[model samples]
Target: MRNTSDISISVVVSCTAQTAALLPWTLKAVMAQTSPSHDIIVVENSAVPELPSMPAREARRLRLLHLPGAARPALRNAGLAAAQGVLVAFCDSGDLWKPSYLAIMREMWRVEPRLLLAYGDAVPLQGDTWGTERGFANAPTGFWDGQRSLGPLLSVFDQPPMPRLLEFQPFLPSGLVAQRGFLERVGGWDTACTLLPGHDFATALRLARHALFGIMQRAMVGVRPEADGPAHAQAVNMGEARILERALARDETLWSQAQVIRAAIVRRRQAALAIAFARGDLAAVQEIAALLPQQERSSPTLLKLGLAALPAPLRRAGSAALFGLGASRTSLRWPGN
Candidate 1:
């Protein structure tokens, strides 16, 4: 068992100057930690102006690594290497961790020293919410939904229903804290998904090989899902997947997981399309849906088609009835209604 006393944790948060506004909430949450990380590395990826003028003394122990060429995986890898702690947690620019976020992770790790990768329920920030109404909402529309289409991709030993992955689009980047050794074993965040789309899914698929993980029933982090520049991110994410597949070319064992990975990717792509359609952006819905592999596009398109086929009166009727249904629902169980 790794001695907790020797454990130092690193929380990686990155932002360009353009997004610096989002990092403060994250920094605030980290500073609020009752169980302080041994080291907190905030990788400033912004080119124009770096992190805000906030004093370093605001947080107990903090270090800022300024990387102008930073991408998500590069920042994560740098933070991981720079991390003096045995455990590492991630909080992105627009996210906020719950008070006990780090503490709960510390306790869980302390209890099971062998545990490698662990993640839990994430409270979605509407900006980032991609699917699921209970996930995060903006007025009449849900920016993100908890529904996951590819549920089977999650590989924890006591895994959730594979189907649930379909509704909630399992494996969020914001709600995870993992051991450095385990991360090293799995090769850190695959820069492949570093873009926008499959990074989380690819990370989940690759990281699962390292352990039988646990799911914290309570939400500990707020994840904003709005991806303003998804095209570029998706392109990068796909490139990373290809890179990862190449890296694993010789390993049949890990390659075995590719099918699950593929399924998860398909679900992820579909979920985004679902949300795009709901947003009433027919062009975006068409563009993204067409990007899906032909065979894979069928179900989601059919689902969209089915939804589009709905009589306007009936759709409006359901919406009217649901107006009374409220905005959010909480469940650690499968999120589908």
Candidate 2:
């Protein structure tokens, strides 16, 4: 195991002009870290680059990179390339970090020298309020036991006896800290996944194939809720589907797990279809439904597809009833349900 006494960390904060206002709070949190990073890099992808004013002490470690109109994946890759620390951490301008976050990560590396990637849990934040739901609330049961520890990282290619890391997305970018070398070895973020919401998940999925992972069970970061509404949800589902498909094509070894990957793709499409149905988006519902195989399409799914052709008023009423019923029957509910 390498000596951890000289660990240096660099934080990458990615933002756009739209989120510039939240940068100050994010930087403030970073500056307050118990174990400060070697540097803080802000990568902004906006037409007009604007930054929050930092005090001299904080400003000394700050560097700004302008990637005009670059997407999140591109901005993050640039940050990875520019980071000078052995360890690199990521946070969005709208997110917050607990003071002990870096300290906990440093200790994790100290204790487990082989750890390639480690992430903490995050609480949901909306403006000034912190939501009770944790970022991993939607993850598979028993996957994260709310304890700080290191463990083997499993991938979708793993068989049933092992918990597949990609079974459900668990890592939040803001809560993640990874070895710089591991990230570079994986070729950084997926630039092709531009405009996709799950680029972080894609990165994590790739890394899972190469190394062991650690988790700090505590909520050490604050994450703003993703934009609500059907369109955003549909986009997320589509992005996840694309990531899974790309994964399958790139690695023939994964073909052994083809059934699992295909099932996950179908689920993402079904989720997109459900979101469209709930929002009474008939066109989207039909579009997503057509992507599903006939065998995978259930009777209720067909009913919803047929209802999409009805008059707007009738369609909306049917949608509302179906949505409410589905919600009520859902066994796996996130916080605030």
TM-score of each: 0.64, 0.86
- Model 1, range 181-202, lDDT digits (tens) per residue? 7787778877754554445555
lDDT of 1: 0.58
**Model 2, C-alpha of 70: deviation from truth (Å):** 0.7
Write candidate 2's Cα lDDT for 66-126 as tens digits: 9988876788878988999999999988889989889878877877767787777888788
Question: Judged by lDDT, which candidate is best?
Answer: 2
Model 2 CA deviation exceeding 4 Å by range: 1-5, 47-50, 145-165, 310-323, 326-337
| Pairs of residues at least 3 apart in sequence or in different chains that clash in candidate 2 | none
List runs of model 1 lying over 4 Å from the truth. 1-6, 47-60, 126-168, 228-251, 254-337
